[model samples]
Structures are given as structure tokens and as C-alpha cells.
Target chain A: MPRKAADEIVIALAGQPNCGKSTLFNAVAGFKVDVGNFAGTSVAFAETRVTFHGRKIRLIDLPGTYSISSHDLAEKVARDFLLSGEVDALINVVDASMLSRSLEFSVQLTEMRVPMVMCLNMMDEAQRKGMEIDTSRLEELLGIPVRTAVAVVGTGIDEVFRQAIRVAGGVVPAVEPRYDNDIEQALSRLLAVYPQALKDALPLSERFVALRLLEKDEDFERKVGASSPDFLARASEERHRLAEREGRAETLALGSHRHGLVLDLYEKVVRHRRGNVLGTREKVDRFIIHPIGGAITVVGSLLITFFLAFFLGNAIAGLVDVPFGALRASIQAMPKGMGPAVLIGLFEGVVAGAGIVLPYLVPLLVLLAIFEDTGLLPRIAFMVDGILHRVGLHGSSVVPLILGFGCNVPSIMATRTLENPRDRFVTMMVAPFVTCSARSVVIIALAGKYLGVLATVALYLFGGLMSMAVSYSLTRSKKRKSLGVIMEVPPLRQPYPRIVVRKVWLRLREFVLVAWPVLIVSSLALSLLSYAGADATINGLLSPLTTSVLQLPAAVGIPLFLGLFRKELTLIMLGAALGTDAIGNVLSNGQILVLVVFTMLYVPCVATLAAQWREGGFKTAAASALLNLGVSIAVAGAVARFVGAA
Target chain B: MEGETAAIHALHSDGATRKRIQSLGLFEGRRICVVARAPFSGPLLVEDVATGARVMIARDLAENIEMESRAPEGR
Candidate 1:
């Protein structure tokens, strides 16, 4: 195969929070990226190469932001990138049904004068809603090539690429909307002071920069730098004069003017009607949002998820046990030696770590991805918004809460969406209590086998209730003002099978990469400890806590240490410590419940700790771990006493 | 003879109006009604459309907002 030359074309896929921007990027780039309905899911830029017409085009998928006004970090990144004029073309992906709001962004992009293409995505949904937008009129009004696309189904994808390539190749004309006369006059004055190189490099004309300066966009001023401060000062003064003459601030005036144009464009091209579908959607929303119905749905979903995890975990555990049983039998049949003991230990460790825990974790993550992709999660957030507000956290924090079900590392990372630092910290500190899949595995394996299904459910509920209580306490300690919840609920769409499968696979791969090495090393270390006399001493020391409080054998201590690296390893090591069938027999139901509860609320895994360190420094990570440890111990002690008494 | 004039507390309409309102939390059962219309046909400040809450939005955007009238004069 001939090597294709890299035709570097920076194409930005921009849209609202859940309008399938990431999904489209995955379809085009053939890579797995986070896709969720709630805001701030994509914080960083993801780049990939796609071959279009035998040319490699580098596509940059930026975080979904509401506007280019630099109100937030995601918006700042999008605005700066567009202003930098480094990109060959901008591909604005709009949700077709929500054209009115989506078009506002396209119009804003047009003012920047970047060679752009409009991809009208979700065409199927638009048609279903009886929306008929005149594409040609829209194209003419925006002065950009428009391509209809159903990105999930891969429709009109080729045309999207073609238009993008054409725009990059300078075949498409840029649309520079005319501003008011006063603004134009100020822009001309500012333009004369700009260096020729700077003028040539910027995507928009000096007029745009002047307008931004008038609006006091810090980023715009920074981009212009010290060289044009005098000019910027004059521009700012002129803008004030213009605003004074118009009897309004320049920024508000400019906003209304742009909004005026947006309204005109929507009036001209977009049409809608009273429809039954809208009514149906509303009725459904009522059911989903009602206090009783919503709570029931949430609990039901969680119950189903647990059952699925249990079923899958048991199957994988059964398969793993067969090989282990065979190996143990064969080893006993062989001559007595250290080799047989070591082999048995190694085989037992691998099966316990990989086979039992991974299957459960992987499926739960898949179900989570599906729930998120299908757009039902945000409704759940809306339902809980009232309670979350009372707790001093915004409803948007629900994304992190839902993600906590899959893994706390990503859940902690999702806290970046919270605008208030205090809120973010509180959310991060409490998020690990959401019963992550790793803990779920431990609960299912231990509580289910020994205690019962009801006990396992109770354990999970305890973890959740504990997390909320901690969050509530943390928020109260700060005595902060209530943060408002502003979230976009993307219309529920069926999750694309391809995207969901790829996301699940990618998440599972990440887990294996991060946890597998740690699991193997921990197993080997534990085996060595057992081989020496150290295991006996360690067990003896842990016996007081395990027996008096937890009421479990001393051997369970080794697994608790392993839980720090990987939660499921605790169950595996526990299984190995107390044989497969005899596990429930040896450890009483109360002991098992305590063990499960402790493991669930225990310190986060090593991967999560590293993520914490990266997200919030070393001090924060240490604080989080130590806090969790104290809570877990206290909770376990209490649970142990209660269960023992019962 | 006319019995009495009820103070309008909700504004309801359909089509593009409903969509504009729906997006802004001005939907059925949402408390809002047009409080005042601007002289220059600018934005309107409406009491809640769904919850009878209050918000101010551009009239151009407001035209798309839909609301229903409160029960006439307390039935």
C-alpha cells in the first residue's frame, strides 16, 4: 500500500452537549470517546486521522460548549481555536430538530469568517418531528455549504467529508456578516494599528477582534497582546461612545443584534406544527420526572443492573473455578513439592482476579454507557435537581454520580463540570461512596453468596446513603450560596449499537490495563508471604479487628490489602483463602456483610488514587483516601455489631 | 353583563411558540405568563410558564414560548 501524504486539515466538530458530536466523531474517526447527554462530558480535545479521498485529514473534536464568548473553559478553548485561525475549516454539527438553537452557534461562527461547513445532523429525528427546514435557504442565509447527516446511521457522511475537504481547499466562500456602522468605523480604526502578520494569521477580520475587545473578552485581548494596547484602548473608548449613542452597552447591543439576525433566519427557514409526538414526549417526561415514578424507575434500573452483574459474575466465576478445581486435584495427585504449591497459588490468583471480577465490571459499564447514551440519565438528573439543590450541589453533578457506578476515577474527573470549587471538592470527596462496579463485584460475590440478595442490595444502599450524607455534611461545612442548575436535556435517542459496543470495549481495556498488572503483582506478593511465615504474623495482627468486629478469619486480611489495588481482588483472594464451596460455611453471614460493606466503602483503588492526585494534588488524594478509610472502618464496626447481635 | 376580568397569569400557544417556551422551562404546568410587552417589541418578562416562576427573555425568543391561562377568577 502506498503511504498517503498527511493532508493536515483541522476540522472542528461543534454542537450542543448531547447532539451526537462525540458519536459522529467516533463514527468518523473510528475511536472510542466519552459520549453523554449532560454538560462538560468532553473537557479535553481528542484528535484522530481519517482518510478522505485518499488524503489523511486530521480531525480535532473539541469539547461541546454553549457559545464562543469564553464564559467557561470549554467555550474558551473553542473560541481561542477558532480565533487562532490555525484550522483550515470549521465543521459546525447541528442537531437538525433543534435547528433554532443550534443555528445560533452557526451564526456566531459565521461572524468569525472561518471557511465553514454546516452538518445538519439528526435529520431523521427532525423528519419524525414534522420539522421541515428549507436547506437551500439556510445555506444561502449562512453562506456556507450545508450537508444533511444522520451521523448515527452514517447517512450523508461522505458529503460531510466532501464539503469539509472543499472548504479546506478554499473552494467554499467565507461569510462575513456586516456589523453596525459605528462598530465598523471602530474596527477600521483598530485595523490600521495591527501588524500585517497578525492580520494575515487571524481567521476573522480586525473588526471582529475590535468587537471582542469592546465586549472585554480577555482572551481576545491576550491574543492581541501588548503590541496593540493603545489601539485596544482607543477601540474600547470608541465602543463606549457608540454604546452611549445607542443608549445600551456595546456587549448587550451586539448580543441583541446577533439574536435579531438569528430570529430572522429561523423565521425565514424553519417551520413547525402542533404534533402528537410532542405531547407523547411530554407525557413521558411527566412520568419520568414525577417524584414517585422517578424514584421507582431509578431503583428499578439499579436493581436490574445488579442482577445482570450477579448473573454475569457467577458464570465467569464458575468457568474460572473449573480450571482451578482441576489444577488443585492434579497438584495433589503429583509428588509433594514447592512447585505444586506455587503453581496452585499462581493459577488460583489469575482465575480469581480476571475471570470472576472483570466479567461483572465490564457488563455493568456497558449498561451504564447505554443508559447514558440513550439520554435517560439527564431526566434522572432533572428529577433529582430539587434534592441536589438543597444539598448545595448543582443538578449537573448527577453525571458524576451516574459515572460513579462504573468507576470513581472517571466520576472524579467529571467534577470539572461543577463551576464552584467548593462544590467540586465536596462532590469528589463523596463520589467514591456511590458503590462503584469494583465494590459491586465484592458485594455480589460475598454478600450474595453468604448473606442473600436483599443483603447485597442493602449494602449498596448503605454506600449510596453514606455518600449523600458525606456530601451533605461537606457542603454544609462551607456555608456556600446555592449554585443554580442549568442543564440541557437532549432528546432521548436509541443508543447506536456500534458506539455502545466500542465504548464498553474501550472501558474494559482501560480497566484491564490499569488493574491487571497490579492484580498479578499483588497475587505474587501474597503467595510469597504465604510461602514464608509472614502471612501468619500479618493474619495474627489483623485477627483482633477481623474477629471482634468483622468476625472473619485472619486470612481475609491479605485480601483487604489487595482491595486497595483492585476491589475484585479482595473477593478472589477471599475465595482462595476460604475455599470455593466452603467460603459461606466458614464466614458467618454477619462477618460476610461486614466484609462486603467495608470493601465497598474502603479507600479507592490505586488507579483512582492516581487519578485523584492528578485531578486534585497529592494532599487531596491522601485526604480522600484517609477519610474513606476512617469511614469504612467505623461503618464496618457498626454493621458488624448490629449483624452479630441480630 | 360581563361578570369579571381575570388577571392573566399564563400564556399558552403551540407550534414554534411551544418549542421556544419548552426549551426555557416554560411548558405545560410551568408557572409563567407575559408580564409586560416592550414598546419597541423587544423581549418580554414573563412569570413562569410551567411553575408560575418568572424569567425575562427576548420577545423574538418569547414569541416561541407558550403558556396556558390560570383558572378564570378562581373558578
Candidate 2:
């Protein structure tokens, strides 16, 4: 939306990836932004309004980007927002620990001539790194108000925003960073030849235009081409001459020029006190990233998370089961008629949702939040790159797969980080098999309750293997080698308990608001269907596969079939279908295992299918659904036969 | 590969990969140290000495970026 209020300051928080831009924005915006330690975590922009000193501040949290030149989707989102000319001021949040690299992006931002405040964020990290940044010196050099902040702890954030508001309200002209003589000369040459009218027509500064053209920024080049085709010819000729003189591509020359400038600037402002001693962070990081030790840490963490969720979920389930069981018995004892039956159906839905799902979901989300905040996901991605390569994927795919454990919708969206379409498609296709938290609810509640913890762990392992096998087969015919991963491994930070709780509540709120309503309505709808005796038809129709092939009860057909809408429905509606919440009494251990496997492998829920359609197009989504159904039948059938044999 | 500083010779990649590499501050002439190398040819974790930015470069991409190793600097 365009700024309707002239007094409203539209300030955007911009920075390099994993530099705490979101954290700072969250600090001011009251936890509206998603803060994760992984780069590219903020794929989209988040905007909120704050009343700072009675002045409305429209705060925008942009996706972290290393440079405006890259065409990655996340970077594109950030670049588009910046170039949109709507931002009144920018908060260039720099990771003070990595001052030089962060300065490169800050330098790039200055070229836009936007009123900006330099926020030396993560001051604690810099201090821990034994580096002291002279903020005043940085302010003096950059000609902008610079503030130091440890955003995580809420240190210096209000002052940083105050500085930004002052910078926006006042005439604080952006100080253009100067480059080496060669780049300056080249830039001047290009600007001198460029038409004044055309330069003024563009939203960016004339110098930024010249630099972008020389650096071959496609979006800028296209804009300039649309304005004046004649200027493009001159720019390319100048670019060629500069590339020849630099003995490299014009893009590389521009980047190196900035690199040299930033290094020189770094030496001027940063003082290293604890010279060369690896801090405890680096020491622990080394052990964590070690091949053997890292493997142990990674595997052990997963096992611990699984067991904790299993036991904790069971305990919660047990606590709630007593009250829900009494409620069910009271409803059943009311009468042996349709009214009581339907009442029991509605009651069972609430029981399954509140008692069964939340028990497992709450602990799992808490752990996932801890994992995300701790910055371990990227390391896992790095460690698994080689293994993924065997399946025609790479480390980048691991992010989406790991995220899939929480839910599939965002996980599919996370595939935007993968550059290759083939990689994205394969990852999207394989990701749904990763057993999202909703599926985990079913697996834990049913499998954990009846089959034991090892059986549940084995089932999760089986899902992982199936995902790998499916991805391998999907890419077997395509011989194009996957691109190697180039990902930033952000420093691990202690997970703040408050933020973790907030994050879990955000996810849990979704289940309460969206999924619970659907659960209750669907439960009621199924009850009505059974009242009309239509569920018998659904169960009978699916019985050919559910009963004959999987050797499960026909009544389970309704839950299994309706589960395509929400995986939890299969478990929620199970008691309603089978006439009892005590599932072990009716279904044996082997039968529950077969049902879990089938539910896990079946077509992803409606939300997931919609996400797949949006991300991979109709054909990919349809093919995926078919592939899932095919795999579920085949695998579940085999499990049933094997169980029978045993 | 560990405890060595290397000046990047060149990135023998074109298009997006090269752009991504350069964007991450892995430009030619920058010195970097291999901090960790995962087993089974996973990825090499390299820290740019000048910037203190650690990047995980997959072995294939690492193979393409030529560099000349030097002895570890004295503390």
C-alpha cells in the first residue's frame, strides 16, 4: 500500500542474511516477525506499524540479502521492495561480528541515496568475537547516525529506531561510498555518456545506475533498455573496455572493487583485542561440525526429540484421556439412539483433537522452535549434502525437508531457495513423505501408544528412507548434475525461551483456529453422514483396499479416506468409526502399524496439495498425488503381509 | 585442508552459481581457510579470513573454485 499519511515514516530493516534484521524488527514490532538463525529465513516481507513517540512508523522487515544484484527469489523480494521507492528510510542492520562483509551490503545500500541509519546489530556477538567496533567512527565515515545494538536481548533497539526516525524526518543525505580510482573513473565515464533525462527518469541514483549497468544487473539493464536502447550499446562497450582493463568480468571487477574498499574501511573501524583465540562458540562449533561428532550430535538430537515427544505426548494424553473417557461414557449412557450416537461422534472428535493431537504437537513444536533458533538446521544441511547428492539433490533441499517435519505447506514454499527448477520439483515431491507434525500426531498417539517407542522411531526412519528412495527414482532418468550448495552457516545462538514459546504458540494457534474448526466440523459432518448411514458406503467402498489389501477393519476406511483432508482426522475419527476410543482393543499392533504407514504415505492433506499446486504447477501436484497413493498401497501392502508372516 | 589459508584463484562457474558465490563474498583474491570438511565428499566449510564469514561450499562447487594454499598464519 502506498503511504497515505505523509507523516508516517515507512522504515525498512535491511541487511545481509542472518544478521538479525528480523530480530531487531521483532524487538520493536512486538514479535510479529519470524526470527530464525538461517539465511533466507525471511522469504517474504513483513510490515507492521508502531507508534514511536506518537509518530506512526511503518516498519518493514525485508528478507536478508547479501547483495541487490543476485536474482534469488528471496533477494528479488528484498530488491523489489527497496527499488519500489516507497521506503522513506532504511535501517541497514549490520552484524558487527562480520563488519567487513556487512559493510559491503551497507555500501551498496548507500548508492540508492535512501535516508538510512547504520545499526551495528549483534553487538554482543562482536564483543564475544573480541572485536570492538567504533560506532562513532563508523557514523563519521558513513555520514549517518550509527547505533550499536544487541537485538536479541533488547539492547539499544529503541535508540536505533529513534535514530532512524530522526534520519527520516531530517535532511540526512546518504553518503555515497567511494570506490578505487579505476572504478571511479569507469563509473564517471559511463555517467558522462549517459543522458541526463534518462538518468532522472529512473528511480535510482545516476551513479547506482551506472554501476548496475557496468556490473550487468539484469533488472537494471532491462529498465535502462526500455528507456533508451542507444544507451545500452554505449554501456556494454564501456563494460567491455572495463572488463578488459580489469582482466576479469565487469561484475567481478565491481565486486572486488567493493571488497577492497570494505576491507580498507574495516581496518579503520574495528579493533581486535583477543587476537586469534577461538572463542567458546567457535570451539563448540568445531566439535559440532566434525564429521563423526556432528553425525552423533545430529542423530542423537533427533532420537531425543522423538522419544521426548512420544513420552510427553503419552503423558499428556493420559492426563486428558480420563476426563474425555468419562465424557464419552456419559454420552454413550444417555441413550442407544441416533442423538446419543451423533453426540458421541462430536465428543470423540474433540477428544481426538484436544487429547491426542495437542499432546504430541505441543512438545514437537517446542523442540522444532528450539532447533530453528539454535541454528543447527544449516549445519545439518551441510553435513547431509553428500548423502543428498546420491539422490540427485543437494544440501539446500534439506532445509525444506527439515521444515516439512513441522508442516508441508511452508516446507514446499521453502523450496523457493533452491535455484534449480528440477531440484525444487524433486524436493517438493519428496518432502510430503517426511511425516509432518500432523502426521506425527497420528504416529505418536496410535503407534507410540500401542507399538512402543522403537516401533515409532522405526516408522519415522522408514518415512525418511521412502523420501530418499522416491527422490532417487524421480531423478534417476535426469542426468543433469545438481548444483553444489553455497549456504551461509550462521553462528549458533542460545534460544530465548520467550521467543520459543511465542513461536510455538504461533503454530499452535493455527491448529486451534484453522485445524480445530475443520476437525470439529468434519467430525460433525461425519457424524451426520453416519446418522444418514452414508459412512457405511464410504467404508464399504474403501474396504477393498483398507480391509482386503491392508487387512484392517472396514470401519477404518472412513477415517483413512477422509484423512486426505487432515491427517489428524484419521486418528480423530477412528474411535467414532470403530465405536470405541480404546483402539488397541479392536486393532492389533500390526494393524495399527499398517494403518499408520498407509496414512503416512497417502496423498498429502488438502493444504499440502494446494501448496504443491501453487509451487510445482498442476501437473507436478497431480503426479505427486498419484505417486503418493501408489507408494502407500505398495508399501502398506508389503507391511501387512510381512506382519502376517511374522 | 584444515589450518590453511588460500587465495582464491578463480571461480570456474558461469551464471547463477557464480553470481551466488560472488555474492557470498567469495570473490577472487580473497583469502579463506577450510574450517571443516564433511565426510563422503559432503561440503567444505571455509571461513573468509578478511570478513570472518563462514560459507559451506559443496565439494563440487569447491572443486571449481581454484585456490593456492598457504601455511597457517602464526598467531
Candidate 3:
């Protein structure tokens, strides 16, 4: 076979959440990616190259969205890429079971003036639900090539892409939405104001821009208004003129009119059975969401995932200690001070990287993958939505919060799926306070050993409560975020190994690619700081707080300082500094409690700091670190003074 | 109106919220099956029968919005 050029034709897979676009992409690309019943599981858009109809094409799977409206991230990602116009064609995936809602977006795509092949996906589910869609009638109505598939089962998938390729090869005219004469006249009047050269530079078709202008989309105002503020003023006038003719808000009038056309199209091609065929799924939902059973099920799952990951991580981590410790001893015994420091620092990074971190991180990520793949997590998110809303988070934000227990970096990555930046910021800010697995280990080693297991659980519960309280306080600002939610409640299904493995792989890949480098480098860097004769100065600076205020030995100061790079080091360094294996011999119960509080609450681990910086930017990340410092000192001091050590 | 269907007369929300609600298939004149109303003026668990997609609306918004009974049982 002859080699194809490297200029692969870019084709996009677009659809609403849970439409199985990922599954179809997985099937065609001969690769696996996350598949989940709920929304936002595929947090980022990714591309894979495949040969379709003897031509190589790059298939990009985008985050799910209902429409091209840029109110949310998913919409922004999809529409931004589409309007870039680099994509040769779009595989517009419509969930056959939810034809009316899905088609609402399909109409918007038609106006984009791009070649598109409509993938009427989930035909098996639609048939199972006693719904019927006439594909020929739909194709005729929308004037686009249509293909049907149950993508999860890999049925009719090849035909879908084949049609897509043919359509992309210039087989059909762009389907433009036809609105009322008055609106069209108003739109033309608005368009006449823009010079042809300027209009050509607009991201979307004149019709789409006109519709958005009528709707008064903020993004359009910002982009177009930059060069031509005069256009915006004229467009507003035209909208009101059209509204006066219709006797309603022009945006609403336009929406009602366009939706009427969609309903007309829907009526022509689709029919529904009188009875709901979702018997089994609904029955199971009733149990999982039953007020009492729901709480138990969610709570039980949390316990199982946390404890399983915790014990398993500890057990495997135990195996790494011998090898890592041996390596550490060999390095330390090799030479004099600086030599030992450099070698030990790098070795410590390695020990922390693979030995300490990965064991705990792996099990937690795998469990989270399973939770999302099975669709159980979103429902838990739904149940907590009411409470979490008090803190300016969506129900979907709960996914990141729960995963924070396992680790914070991946949880921070999970916030990408949240539509609103405010939600993402607030969630990211509060997530570190969720007390991660490493913190849990710290609490167990310190509080459980000294204060009792009850105290350990109490500290975890207290951390959770403080996070929520702080989050609620954060939402008290005057930013005016709407707390309303419109999240999907997907049926829980058994996770396919292929899909779940893909999710876990992508997550761990992120761990390796982004988080690990920072973890290792920061570990080495902090060690180099200690080697450069700064430990005494750092210990001296922290002495007042560690020795006097929170009532701990000056030795504890180094661990407190080092905990920022990797939190588990609070325990490891405390032992090293004291030169003893038995921690109980060095501190009182209340003193131990204060030390635990200090480590647990102060500055998030360096890996988490890196994640925060990457996601929330430097200002917010720095603000988070400073805030943690303040809160840790205040809370730890209060506890130490009130409890009074033996 | 507990078990009956009702048309969304107006969303009583701003431009973006209204448009988003429409994307969920709940536009003006669209029918919704009211599954259950939570106690203490909480969220309303409602379903769009046509799409078989359900949503929980905050009680505050649900109250301000006006709707007419679409089905004979609630009509």
C-alpha cells in the first residue's frame, strides 16, 4: 500500500453527554478511552488517527454538550473547534432514545454550514424503549446523510464513518435554518451594517451570527464588539424591532419559533409508545436513591473505596520500603555531606515517586474509574447537590470532591468537566481540605496511635465540615451565580474493562506526565534547600510555632517544612529527625494531635500545589497556599492550647 | 399537579438560563411530567416525557415560573 500524506483530514465526533461518542471512537480508532453513563467523564477532548474509506482521518472526540451556546465549557470547546473550520466534517452523534433533545442541537449544527454526517446512535436502546425514528424521513427533513448505530455494541459503526467520509468529500449542501421573514429581514438589516470583509472574518455563518446577535450572546458582543461597537448597537435595535412585530422578547421569540420548527421536524419523523419502557432501570434507581438506602449505599461505597485503597496501598507500599531504604542507605553511606545530600535527594525523589505515591494513587484512581464508568458517582453527586449548592458547586462537582479522598491531583483534573469556572475554582480551592489518603495515613499514625481511632475519624469528619463551611463562606460573595442544576441521571451499568481501563490509563498517564515530574523535582529541590545549610534557619523560623505555640520539639519543624513537598514525609521526616522508630516516645497525646493538625491542615503537598497552579493559575494557587498556612496555624494553636498535653 | 403534566409557560430566568433549560427540552409550550416535589420547598424532580430526561429544578425558580396543565388529568 502507498503511504498517505501526513496531513490527516480532521473529523470530529460531537454529541450530548452519554451518547456513546467515546465508545464509537474507541471502536473505530482501535484504542480505548473513558466511557461513562453520566456527563463530564470525558473531561478533555482527544484525537486518534484512523483510516476511513481508504483515506486517513484524525477523529477527535469532544466533551459532550447539548448545543453550541458558549454558556459552559463543553459548548465552548465543541463550538470553538467547529468554528475554527479546520475540521473537514463532523460526525454529529444523536442519541436515538432522546431524539427531541438531541435534535435541538442537530438543528444548530446545520446552520454552522459545515459538511456533517448524522450518526443516529443508540438504535438498540431506542428500539428497546419502544421509540421509532424513520431515518430516511429525518435525512430528508434535515438534508444530511444519516447513519444508525448502537455504538456500545459496535453495531453499524463502520457504515457511520463510511457515510461521514463520503459526505465530507463534498456530497451535500450545508443545511441552513429557515426562520420567519421578519426575523430574517431584521438579521439582513443587521448584517448589512457589517462590511463584507468583516463578515468573512466572523467565526460562524451570517445566519448563526444573526441568531446569536438576536439572542444577545455575550461572547459575540465581546469578539465582534471589539472591532465594531457600532454593530452591537444596531443589532440590539434590530432585535427590538423584530420583537415589537412579534410582541415578545426577541430572544424568546426566536427560540420559540426555531423550537417550533424542530418540533415539526420531530413530529414528522419520530413516534413514541404510550408506556415508558424504562422499567428495570427505574426500579434499580428507586433503590439506589431511596432516601435511606441511597445514603447507606453511597457512604458504604466511600468507605470501601477509601479503606480498600488505603490498606492495599499500605500493603504494597510496605514491599517498596525494603528496596527503597536499602537504596537510601547505600547512597547515604557513599560519601561526605554534599555528595550524600544530592544523591539522597534524587534517591528520595525516586523513593517518594514510585515507592510512596504510586501505590496509594493507583488503587484510588482505579476505583474512581470504576465509580464513574458504572454511573454510580453522578447519582451520589445528585443526592449531594442540594447541600453542595450552598457552597456554589454543581452536583457534578461532587465527583471531584469524592475523588479528592484518594488523591488531589486527579481530583483537580476532574474539575475540567465542570462547566462554570466559578464552580471549578471554588471546587478546586475547597478540594484540598477534603483530607486525602496521605492525610488519612498521617491522622491514623499520629491521632490513632496517641488520641485513639475515634479521634482519627473525628479529625477526618472535622476536615470535611471545615471545607464545606469555608466553601459556603466563599459563595457568600456578590458574584450572583445561579445554583440551578440540570444534570443527567444515567442508569448504572456494569463497567466494560476496555472503557474502565482506558480511563485509568489516561489518569495514570497524567500522573506520570504532569504530576510526577513536579513531585520528583520539588522533592529534590526541597532536599537541596536543606543541603544548602537552610534547614537550621528554617527550623529556627518555625521554632516559635512548633516549639512554643503548638508545643512540639524543634525537630518537628523540619518535617512541617518538608511536608509541603510530599505530605507523607511529615511522618517519615519526624522519625528521621528524632532518630527513633517509636513516635509515641517523643510526644504527648495532645501534642501529637496538634502536630497532626498542623501537617494535615497546612500547605497542600507540592504535587497538589502544582495541580492548583496549572488549573487555577498562580494567583489563586498562591492564595490557596497562604490561606492553608493561616488556617493551619490558627486551628492547630487553638487545639493545642485547649486540649493541654500530658 | 403532582402526577400531572404541565407546559412550561415561562422560565422566569435570564437569557442564558432560559436557553439552557430549552436545550434540556423544556422550552415554552414543552410538557413536563412532575414526578415528585420534595418537602420543605426543595427541588422538583420533573421529567421531560418526550426526551425521557429528568431534571431537578430549584424550588425558587419553579415557584416563579408559570405553567398550564397540559394533560387532561391535570388540565
**Winning candidate number (lDDT):** 2
Per-residue lDDT of B1-75 in model 1, one digit per residue for the tens?
012222332334433233334334343333344543322232343543212222334444444434344456665
Residue A310 displacement in candidate 2 (angstroms):
1.2
Model 1 lDDT per residue over A1-646, tens place: 1232445666777776666788788888775576555456777788787778876787888888756776577787887776665678888888887676666677777767777888999898887767778999888878899989998888898898888888784644445665656666666777777666556545466666766777666677776655555666776777677778767545544554554566678788877654545556546645654557767777777777988888777787777777767766776577745676576567666766567767678778788888887767766665555565566564557778888888898888888877777777777787778888888887887787777878777777777778778778777767556444444556666777877788787887776776766676666666667767588787787887776767777889888877887787887778666645468778777777788888888899888888888888898888899889889888899988798789
Candidate 1 positional error at A121, Å: 1.0
How big is the positional error of residue A276 in model 3, measured in Å on the Cα after superposition?
A: 7.1
Candidate numbers, best TM-score first, in rank order? 2, 1, 3
Cα lDDT, all candidates:
0.70, 0.84, 0.74
What DockQ, between 0 and 1, does each candidate earn? 0.05, 0.75, 0.47
Clashes of each: 17, 0, 0
Provide TM-scores for the models: 0.84, 0.95, 0.82
lDDT of 2 by residue, A456-549 (tens): 8899999999999999899999978888788888887788887788789878888998988888888887888887889988888888998889
Interface RMSD of each: 13.1, 1.2, 2.8
Candidate with the greatest TM-score versus the true structure: 2
Full ranking by lDDT = 2, 3, 1
DockQ winner between 1 and 2, please give it. 2
Docking class of 1: incorrect
